[model samples]
Target: MTEEREPGFQEPIEYEEECENCEVRVAAICQSCGMPMNSAADYGGGNEDNNCCVHCCCEDGSLKSYEEVHQSMISLFMKTRGLDKERAEQAARDYMATMPAWIGR
Candidate 1:
């Protein structure tokens, strides 16, 4: 039986070809911010092949520097969540640590 999803909800498109090898279905997500890339508009350069999101890309389609992305995330958290500078910075750092772009750094 088919299940019902809320309006505007799109099933995540798996980017990986070797689905059997993957323990979990890997959705197309922004390498920088971990945002799910549900549509072409969600990807950097409006290209589905891009690994990052539009927010994490420069006008020329290159990924932004780590510091630039870090600052943006911090500001977003501060503005949206009403978090203080220190808390926002820490939250951004923690969140970025899990993202593919910032995994090692």
Candidate 2:
């Protein structure tokens, strides 16, 4: 059955696929938050472990809680991608909602 969408809900974004094994199958999305991870290799580069984007992990290579990850992801997307604040906020929420297993505490 087709589901109804909320008013003013934008469709999910389509991203490039230059990187391999991206979790979302989008070119430059972070596996954790499903946002763009377009920083240089030394800074948030993609890795074989789920191809998680650099920003998705801490400097020590630990994963952030879902809330923290999504918040940072939304902010980065807003500044780097010039996305609308409200839309980015919603996107962050939606992405987090889909991955409750990673959202510890």
- Candidate-wise lDDT, in order: 0.80, 0.56
Question: Residue 53 error for model 1, in Å?
Answer: 0.1
User: Per-residue CA lDDT of candidate 2, range 1-105, in tens?
Assistant: 997754433343334443455544444445455545444452243343333456667665566667678788689769987889898888777766554234422
Decoy 2 TM-score against native: 0.45
Best by TM-score: 1
| Residue 63's lDDT in candidate 2 | 68
Which residue window of length 10 is worst by lDDT in model 1?
Answer: 5-14
Off by over 4 Å in 2: 1-30, 35-47, 99-105
| Top model number, lDDT | 1
Model 1 segments more than 4 A misplaced: 1-27
Tens-digit per-residue lDDT, 16-81, candidate 1: 434776675456878788787777787888877788888999865689999999999999999999
The TM-score values for the models, in the order shown, are: 0.72, 0.45
Clashing pairs in 1: none
Q: Number of backbone collisions per candidate, in order?
A: 0, 3
